[model samples]
Each structure stands twice: as structure tokens, then as C-alpha cells.
Target chain A: MTVKVQREDFDVGAELAAMTRGKTSIGGVTLFVGLVRDMAGGESVSAMTLEHYPGMTEKQLEAIEAEARARWPLDDALIIHRYGRLEPGDQIVLVATASAHREAAFESCHFLIDWLKTKAPFWKLEATPEGERWVEAKDSDDAAAARWANQDGDQKG
Target chain B: MKVLYFAWLRTKIGVAAETVDLPPEVKDVGGLVEWLKTRSPKHAEALANSKVVKVAVNQEHVPYDHPLSPGDEVALFPPVTGG
Candidate 1:
């Protein structure tokens, strides 16, 4: 298990390679990368500043990763989330899960990102043409996380 | 106890964190908010709506009714929009 919150960017290929260096037992790997969008709510965004609680962010992420591990037969899992100011097209987060099969890898990867959206303590402030505005938590994000909670038995890997 | 604010709450409150000596009447997270509101108009305004403010006790998310200890670290902020 690996979890990190940093101000610098990350390399996806390097991270994936390091995660599965000598793990021949792993059959499949699933990854999700969250990027800073140039537009939000139909407005053009110039920059996005990510703010997070220093200690609590790592604690919450660790808890989220642990939950995914407990629910799946994952050989390894990695969560790298970046903080501080970022412009459009910058990578904001990466969630990768490796398992012996594709199903566990795919589902656990999705679960990690979905849970992170609602449970994590980071907030985004987008600088739009109008002004700097804080992004609001979407109901769709809550619904996304809720589906996993609803189908707990079927999704267990 | 150390009380922290973040995001817009930090901006509105004009300070990131502060140490406060709680009165005897403050025993839970809800009571802490009520007591903190009296610190200044900014505190009262930022924490006016209890429904919008999220609380964490000692780096863990908890409900407003969660009990508080003498040295517990408390944080207040808006709903998380992180990815």
C-alpha cells in the first residue's frame, strides 16, 4: 500500500513500474488519473488551487485505501494526490490497484477514487474569468460513492 | 485545545488556527462551535450555519455531537470537494 500527498507532479509510468516491479503474481492493473480541467460549470478556469488539511488528508487517504484493501483481494494499491496551485491539464491525482484478476483491480480502483471524492479533506478553488470561486461538492459524486455502499455483498472481491 | 479552520472558513475567520481554553460548559463539538462563535463576529459569521460546516476531532471526521477532550485538535471546514 502506498499513499502520498505532495506539491509536485508525478509520473504515471514510473509509479506503475515501481508498484509492480517484481510482483509476477499480479495479473491486471487498473488506474485512474484525475486532471485539472480548463473549464468548470461552463466557465473557463485559469488555475486551480488545491487546499488540504496537512495531517488529516493523509490519515483520511490511508483509511480510504485500507477500506479498499479489506473489500478486495488486492496485491498492491497506490494513491498519489497532489496539492497546491495547478493550471489546466495538470495531473491532480492517481489511483492504481493491482490484483490477480481484472475484476478486483478494476472495482477496487473505482472504489478508491469514488470514496476519495467525498471522504477526502481536499478542496479546490478555481480561478475563473469572473473571479476565484470554491468548487462545490456535487450530489453526483455522493451518488457515485453510494452505489458501492449499496452493493457491498456483490462487489466484495 | 487547538482549533483549526480551513479553505473559506480560514479565509473568513482571518486565522488558520488558534489555541483556546474551553469553558466548563463546552463538552462536545456542537458546544465548541457555540463557544467559538462568541470569540468574534467573524467566527460567528463563518460558523453561523451548522449544517454547512464539517467538523473533525483529532484529524478524524466526526459529528457535531462527538465529545471533545481538553487537548483534542478540532477542525472546521466546508464539505470536501476533493478528488
Candidate 2:
């Protein structure tokens, strides 16, 4: 498993190749990449700045990655989140999970992103036509994370 | 103790971090926040709504009733919105 918080962009192809280089047992890989949008809340967004709590951010991410591993029989997992100024269509984050079966890989990937949305300590501020505004936390995001709570029976190989 | 703020809380407070000597009565995160609000108007404005402001002690998320120590590191910020 790996977690990376950086300002530089990542190459999806290279990262995937490196992850599965010698892992012949892996049968499936699921990944998700978040991107900056040009429009938000009905306003035209020119740019976005991602702010994070540095030390605490890494610790929380590692904790959640560990949680994902405990609940899923997975071969590998990865989380890459970016920070700082970004324009529309810029990559913000990436989550990937690998397992012997497609079900485990797919479910774990969904769980990681759901948990990351609410538990991670990063914030986004968008520069709009009027001015910059901080993105508000959505209740829907919290609900998405909450659905996985108490789902102990969902754990599978 | 050291206190840190992030995002809008930092912007509203006009500072990112500060070192403060806690009062004897401040024994928990909630108490520390109440005391901090008394420090300045900006602090009061930033922390006016404690429900929206989340707190962490020593880089770990904790309840408002979580106990505090003299040398602890405290951070206050809003709910996370990342993916």
C-alpha cells in the first residue's frame, strides 16, 4: 500500500505499471481520479487552490488506508492527493485498489474514495469571476462516508 | 501549548498559528476554545460557531471533551472536503 501527498502531477500509466510490475497474483485493478471543474455552484471557476494540514494530512491518510486494508482482502492500494494552485481539468487526487478478484478491487476503491472525501484534511478554494471562495463541505459527502459505517458483514476476500 | 488554524478559520483569525499559555480552568478542548475566544475579536468571530469548527489534539481527531495538557499541540479547522 502507498499514500502520497504532493504538489506535482502523477502519471497514471507509470504508477499503474510500477504497482503491478511483479505482482502476478493480482487479477483486477480499480482506480479513480478526481479533477478540478471549470464551473462550481453556478459560477465559472478560473482556478483552484488546495490547502492541507501537512503533517496531520499524511497521518490521517495512512490511517484510512490501513482501515481499507483491514476490511478488504486486497493485494495493494494507493492514494495520491495533490495540493496548491490548479486550473480546470487538473488532476486533484487518485485512488486505486488491486485484488485477486474484481469485486474486492472495485468495492475497496469505492470505500477509499468515500472515506477520503470526509476524513481527509484537505480543503479547496476556487477563484471565480467575482472572487475566491472556499468550498463548503457537503452533507452528501458525509452521508456517503456514513453508509460504510457498521457494514462489518461487507468484508470479503 | 501551540495552537494552529487552517482554511477559513486561519483567514478569519488573521494568523495561522500561535503559542499560548492556557489558564488553569482550561482542561479540555472545549474549555480551551472558550478561553481562546476571549483572547481577541478575531478569535471570537472565527470560533463563534463551535459546531462548524472541528478540533484535533496532537494530530488526532477528538471530542470537545477530550482532555488537554500543557505541551499539547492543538489544531482547529472546518469539516474536511476532499476526495
Candidate 3:
């Protein structure tokens, strides 16, 4: 497993290739990338800035990825998140998971993203036409992460 | 002890971080927030809506009742909105 927090953009293709170069047992790799949205809270966002508690951010992300590993039988996992100023359409985060089967890879990827959304220490500020405003955490997100609270063991794999 | 603010809280509070001596009466995160509000009007405005402000002790999310120590690091901010 790997976790990276960087300001520079990453080559997803190269990252995936390097991750699965010699892993013949891996049957599936699931990847998800988050981007800066132009529209947010019904306003037109011109630019955005991501802020994070540097030391805590990495620790939290590693913990989140570890949780996904514990829940699924996975071969490898990676999480990349960016910080600093970004324009619309900029890549913000990426999650890649590999497994012998697709179910574990898919579900674990989804779980990692969900947990990262609420558990991570990163915050966002969007430069809207009205002005800059801090993004609020949606209750729906907390509810989404809460679904795993009762999950005890591997039910889908 | 050190108190760090992030995002809008930093903007509202007009500072990123500050060092302060822990008061004897302040035993937990909630008490710290209450005492911090007295430091300035900006702090009061930023922390007025306690429901929206979140706190972390030593970089770990904790409830308001979480205990504090003399050398601990405390961060105040809004809920996380990232993926």
C-alpha cells in the first residue's frame, strides 16, 4: 500500500503500471480520480484551494487505507491527494486498489474514497463568483461512511 | 499548548496558530474552546456556532469532552470536505 500527498500532478497510467508490474496474481485494478468541479453549491467556481494539516493528513489517509485492507482481501492499495491552489478540472485525489477478484477491489476502492471524504483532515475553499467560501461537509457523506459501522466481516467477497 | 486554526476559521480568527499556557480550569477540548472564545471577538465570532466548528487534539479528531494536556497540539476547523 502507498499514500502520497503532493502538489504536482501524477501520471495515473504510470502509477498503475508500476503498481502491477510483476503481480501476476492480480486480476483487477480499480481506480478513482476526483476533480475540481466548476459548479459547487449552485455557484460557478473559478478556482479552488485545498488545505490540510500536513502531518495529520498522511496519518489519517494511511489509517483509512488500512481500514479498507482489513475489510477486504486485497493485494495492493494506493491513495494520492493534492493540496494548494487548483483550477477547475484539476485532479484532486486518486484511489487505486488491486485484488485477485473484482469485487474486493471495487468495494474496497469505494470504501476508501468514502472514508477519505469524511475522515481526512483536508478542507476546501472555492473561489465562487460571489466570493471565497469554505465547503461544508454534507450529512449524506457522514451517512455514507456510517454504513460500514455495522459491517463486521467479509460479506461481499 | 498550541492552537491551530484552518480554512475559514483561520480567516475569521485572523491567525493560523498561537501558543498559550493551559489554564487550570480548562480540562477538556470543550472547555478550551470556551476559554479561547474570550481571547478575542474574532475568536468569539468564529467559534460562536459550535455545531459547525470541529476540534482535533494532537492531530486526532476528538469529542469536545476529550481531555487535554499541557504540551498537546489542538486544531480547530470546520468539518472535512475532501475525498
Cα lDDT of model 1 by residue, A1-157, tens digit:
9999999999999999999999999999999999999989999999999999999999999998999999999999999999999999999999999999999999999999998998889999999999999898888988898888888855321
User: Which candidate should be chosen as best, given lDDT against the real structure?
Assistant: 1
Which run of 10 residues does model 2 chain B get worst, by summed lDDT?
B74-83
Cα lDDT tens digits, model 1, B8-27, are 99999999999999999999
Question: Which candidate leads the pack in DockQ?
Answer: 2
- Give one digit per residue, the lDDT tens place, for model 3 in A42-150: 8999999999998989998998888889889999999999999999999999999999999999999988998899889999999998988889999999878877664
For each candidate, the alpha-carbon lDDT, in order, equals 0.94, 0.92, 0.91
Q: What's the residue-level lDDT of B2 in candidate 3? A: 93
**List of clashing residue pairs for candidate 3:** none
Write one digit per residue (lDDT tens) for candidate 2, span B1-83: 99999999999999999999998999999999999999999999999999889999989888899999998999999998777
Q: Which ranges in model 1 have alpha carbons more than 4 Å from their true place?
A: A153-157
Name the better of 1 and 3 by lDDT. 1
TM-score of each: 0.96, 0.97, 0.96
The residue ranges of model 2 lying beyond 4 angstroms of the native Cα positions read A153-157
Query: What TM-score quantifies how close candidate 1 is to the native fold?
Result: 0.96
Give, for candidate 3 chain B, the lowest lDDT window spanning 10 residues.
Answer: B52-61
Better of 2 and 3 by lDDT: 2
DockQ, all candidates in order: 0.86, 0.88, 0.84
